[model samples]
Target: MKRRKPRILTLYVTERCQARCSFCRIWEKGNPKDAAPAHFKALLTEARRLFGRIFVDFTGGEPLLYEPLPLLLKQAKEAGLRTSVTTNTKLYRQRAEELKGKIDYLLFSLDGTREYHDQNRGISLYDTVIDSIETARRLGEWPDLLMTVTRENIKMIPHVASIANHYKLIFQINPVFSYFGNTGLTEQDVKMMKEYIAYHKTYVNYAQLRLISRGGNSTLQPSCRAVTSQIVIDPQGRMLLPCYHHALDRLDTEGSLKKAFDSTLRRWYEKRQGTFDFCEGCTINCYFDPSFEYMRNQAALLSLSCRAKYAWLRYVERPIEEAFKNRKRGEL
Candidate 1:
């Protein structure tokens, strides 16, 4: 019997965003066209049929702005898929209750401290996002904090980890990818990343060590998974994205997800030496790094260990007051 793929399906419900962040290539212009409810229903049906453990992530300029988000999530859950959303958290509070059971995880994009966050996202967004996260925690939603490490906020890494610890939250540290439309990193920005990596090496390494020691794996690693296990469907339902950055660069559809997985993608992964011009100079976590690891299984053990450690921490060491304080301080 053939092994089923471990697939993650992401839907860009809308392109309408309220914040004008400098780093975002996709949300630079508002996405006026959205996937209608009927189309979404069809996509969900296809997702349920094609993969085992269907994981759905609804994203957008702001997915919450999509009028039928709650309904879409409800349908996904009803189909028995693990559902998540990546949002700026500006509309979290208003939709928390409705999303309580439907969403398995709320991945909030939190950059840094209030001043730093507001500067990167928009005016007062940091506070609003913090408040929304706190509320979600209080309501038992257990949201995960996703920090995109950019040149502007790299210095605050330790502080961010401290906040995650305080909030009893699982943190995903993503190095910012330079894409078209976003200002490419300067020498100073590169320098800042190096400094940030050096400064927080202890905490970052320790956390990773602990995670590995406990058997936790990072979902972000092992990049060929996108070709084999993950499928990103844009607002227009175009499939087989090289990466989110690629998808945003143009809503180009190369082939159906099924065809890609069964044909060219399979050949690339199986052969283990193929390269795409698009893969060069790419830093998007959704692709480049994972491809390298998948080819060699370089960090599998550490990844599994880290995941285990995280589970242990979640069950045994998660704190309450600290969690709230972390949010209040904009550390998370």
Candidate 2:
């Protein structure tokens, strides 16, 4: 098996969010302290030293709301690492210029059309998202639109994809999963989602879908790369062990990110990773997505190959058809 170094870093920049979404509860946690700037400074350097140029993703209740986001992203870029930020786009307008060159990839959240998305968000911010999308385009930033699909909004999947199509941008879909006791997905929901993925050329994590049907990581043994391939960090500068959804422990990194990672507690967790009792039924994507590449199993490797094909098709497939149509029109 080829050794996999840490290539992705997920930083929950802040726990403060205003949008009250129906499917998620990250906003309900009120306001938690974001990791100290020093913590990020350490990570920006130490992480590059320990792990080669990692892909850092700044996520949150809404990453744009984090005050230190611009500086942190700038630092990540200066460290010569690729950076990404998955934002709700609430603060895109205010922070746009600040983050212009820092972010290599930017993902915007959408549930469905204006009405459905507004309902799902528990706020009338659908217009806000659209405005942000337009603004992003004006700035020459082509961002991917991500829809968090639930049973209620699953039917609107194609509609949202059309929105992405209308903009000539990439689209992504992720089925809603239980987190922090917020369980709404059912077996029927899983069936519908599976059926939906079968037809759409969008990005789908089959492992996550399979686990969703089995009621979590229950049937599948954890070959997780949660902490191995990508490091999940909490707002207060601690590394979430195993994965974020079923994190049994959090290791602090007050001084050295490398030393703290090498500590007794984290090492123990590393040794027993993916085998923890909670790890049995966990379907967390942040950990599992990166794990696919590091998989040593022959069966998993083949599955990865199929997923990679679709992932490639997702971006170019539609554009190729559009170009063909234009070429035909020109000939006519």
Candidate 3:
């Protein structure tokens, strides 16, 4: 069998964000240094040559705030790569026309009703997300709702899911990581999460919900597949090793990714990921969700026979998944 190439690229395009969110500290980096469009041009070119098939995500303190995003997205498109963006949608309006056809996937955040959302973000922008979703739909783009769930905003899951359903979009929730400073999700929060995702099986990330419910990224064994199929690039053009969750070190991006990835340092981290002292009880979804995968039928069969949520998935969810794929492919 051939070695698997990294399938996903997450580019942190900028380190400056307008929102002062309670859980994230990226905004405090202020006006930091990072790549210009020329750097991204070179990086994307190397990425395309190194990995025959890749999915590129442009993220940031606020990717929409990055002035050269349009040109960058166009460059990736012309290179024959799929592109995506994860944004708060705060500045989507001003860039909507230019970004319309460029983004292949979009993740818009909605924590809860206006009061809760503004409080969590330390900014006032609940209404902006709603309007941005409408705008994206107009442009033939269906952006999902990604809520950062913590004790402060866990109750918003259903409300956000309703927004996703109303707009015909997927709903993804990520539990707060302990290192980001929250005490981690309480049992109650996890219970509520399990129940919601279980009932809303069709649209929710059912597989991820089940994993996190069992304590995400907390096992001792190397269940993570980061080095095998994913890489996260910071704004300064450095790779976050193992995964961005436990960035033990930053590898230089001054050379071709193929060489950097195949380095002995990369090999060491890949083999030793789940053994670190800090890895004992880690539960960062950014690392776990992307790094985990298995045979679909294996889980489906077990769940169909025993789990209530997946029972329905076996009988009814496949078509729903198919329709979603069709919609994602612009067939519906």
Ten residues in sequence with the least summed lDDT for candidate 3: 294-303
Pull out the clashing pairs in model 3: none
Task: Compute the lDDT of residue 22 as modeled in candidate 1.
Answer: 64
lDDT of 3 at 58: 90
Q: Please, what are the lDDT tens digits per residue for candidate 1 over residues 47-131?
A: 6877846878888878988879999999998888889888888888888888888887678878889888888876568777778
Per-model TM-score, in order, reads 0.74, 0.86, 0.84
Candidate 2 Cα lDDT to native? 0.76
RMSD of 3: 5.2
Ranking by lDDT: 2, 3, 1
Error of 3 at 229 (Å): 2.5
Residue-level lDDT of model 2, residues 169-228, one tens digit each, is: 677777676565666467688777656553344666666666567666542566666767
Per-residue error for 244 in candidate 1, Å, reads 3.7
Error of model 3, residue 270, in angstroms: 1.1
Candidate 3 C-alpha lDDT tens digits along 49-127 = 9886588989888898899999999999989988988888889988999998887767898888889998888888899
Local distance difference test scores for all models:
0.63, 0.76, 0.74
Residue pairs that clash (backbone atoms under 3 angstroms), model 2: 217-280, 217-281, 218-281
Q: Tell me, by lDDT, which candidate is best.
A: 2
Q: Tell me the spans in candidate 1 whose CA falls farther than 4 Å from its real position.
A: 1-6, 181-225, 247-274, 288-296, 315-332
Stretches of candidate 3 above 4 Å error? 197-202, 294-332
